[model samples]
Target: MSSPPVSAPPALEVTGLSHSFGRRKALDDVGFTIPQGRFTVLLGQNGAGKTTLFNLVTRLYSNRSGSIEIMGVDLRARPTVALAKLGVVFQLRTVDLDLSVKQNLLYHAGLHGLSRVQAQARIQAELDRLSLAERANDKVRQLSGGQVRRVEIARALLHKPRLLLLDEPTVGLDIGSRQTIVDHVRQLCATDGLGVLWATHLIDEVRADDAVILLHQGRVLAAGDGATLCAKAEVKDLGQAFTKLTEARAA
Candidate 1:
């Protein structure tokens, strides 16, 4: 008899994850898996411990309990190997305002140990992909908020990480700009086979086919595709489903 095909591990996985800030528990027994080559929305309202989870995953904060794994590698046991597969665009912008877009990207590339020639090629590819090629020579301060956010996204991808994390990436953008980013990232997932963990409180960003993890008060209330979540909640849309889930937990 032929053996069944073995399945690849998730792009990212968290098991029994928890964190605290002194007396306040920021995350409580949180766990979820992000599949490879897919876009998974970490849906939660502000102060829902979304950032806390990201911090732990990125090693910005020490994980006091539980575990994080990236592409089947244990983060605690093999941090460098685990982190090499991760990319992040934080909620706060980190690019230097005085530096040109290309300069910023080159600096980031150098940090990842890419040589100047290699960095140049990757920089061109990302800038072109993000529609920022014309703006590559312009100082970051010269760009609009939406353009700046695009630069951050491009910079994040320079290292070619398999898993990309974005925390509240569209917080202050116009609807058009927000939608542009949403479309571009979705296209990346389809074309490049990149796995994304997008953290957002915005309900409109969640699509029916996308994987959704509903987090409230640092706990995962639901995990499934958007359509399935709506069906399980007995709701017609994701917004109503989210409200029903959170409110039920509060009660």
Candidate 2:
């Protein structure tokens, strides 16, 4: 007899998720699973509810009618517990401009209730990984945009989260800065086995093999490996694939 198929638990899972305002549905029964250690990008145009989904995951906007599980913990049942295993970098720059990089990190560590010694060690390690050790004491405002962005990332990782969520993190950054941030995030996800959900408008930032969910008009129109979807359309890159997909949806 053939063996039964094995199943792997997802690092992040959403089921029957739906949200709406008066006369408007922002998310209509959207569902997807992100396997552990994958770089998953959520793609969409404005008003497609990409950020709304991000907010749902982060619990900024409560999910009135769905389930979200992170690392097997139900977000609604145990929000704090589920959130503890996740790190987030929002679309806006979140670093304290007046605070030194080290100080900013220290504050974040404290927010998670880390002791001084523990925070110090964690901060040092993250700075080293991002190659920001040499300028750790500089105020964030004094640093370049790229450096400030890196500091925000370092702060997010101070808790040693297993899942990282970045919402349009590279928005407004120069080409070089954008590439640098993308490279660092890609490397971190691959090397540390960290699950990442990066929401962005730029198709070039996501790799073809990475998982992708295309949100259109408050609905998920497609979800799969980027390369596979692109191949289905004979597209050379994600940009072309996105154009094809969205155009078809509109038609």
Candidate 3:
């Protein structure tokens, strides 16, 4: 008889994750797995501890109470190896406005230990991928808000991390720009086999087929495919389902 195939570990996993500041709990035993090659939306409102979760995963805040793993590597035990498989676009913009787009990406590439020739090649490829090739030499201050966001995405991907974490990536853009970013990231998950954890409060961004984790305050209220959550809530759409879930939690 042939041996059974081994399953791949999840792209990202958090188990029994908890955090607190003083007496206020920020996260309470949160746990979820982001499967490889899929888009998972961390759906929540403001103050929902989404950023806290991101902080723990990215090691911005020390994970005092729970475990985080990347590609089956424990984050605390193997920081460098675990972080090597992760990329992040934080909620706040981090690119330098004074530098050209290419310069910004090159600086990021260097931080990841890429030499000049390697950085240049990867930068060009990502610029082309994001349709920002024409803007490569332009100062970041000259780019529009959406273009700046794209630049951040390009910078994050310089190392080709397997898992991408985007925190409220579309918060400040116009609807057209928001949709463009959303569609592009979804395409990455589909075509490039990149696992994504997209944190957002915008209900419209939740699609029926996408994995959805509904978080309120510091806890996960529900988690499943969007279609399943809506069906369970007896609602017509994700928006209504979200409303129902949050309201019940509040009550």
Q: Quote model 2's TM-score.
A: 0.93
Model 3, poorest ten-residue lDDT window? 1-10
lDDT by residue for model 2 over 108-161, one digit each (tens)?
999888899999999999999989999999988999888888998999999988
Model 3 ranges with Cα > 4 A deviation: 1-6
* Candidate 2 weakest ten by summed lDDT: 1-10
Any idea what lDDT model 2 has? 0.87
Give the distance in Å from residue 60's predicted Cα in candidate 3 to where it truly belongs.
0.3
User: lDDT tens digits, residues 163-196, model 1?
Assistant: 8999989999999999999898888787777789
Residue-level lDDT tens digits of model 3 in 139-161: 99999999999999988889999
TM-score of 1: 0.96
How far off is residue 249 in model 2, in Å? 1.3
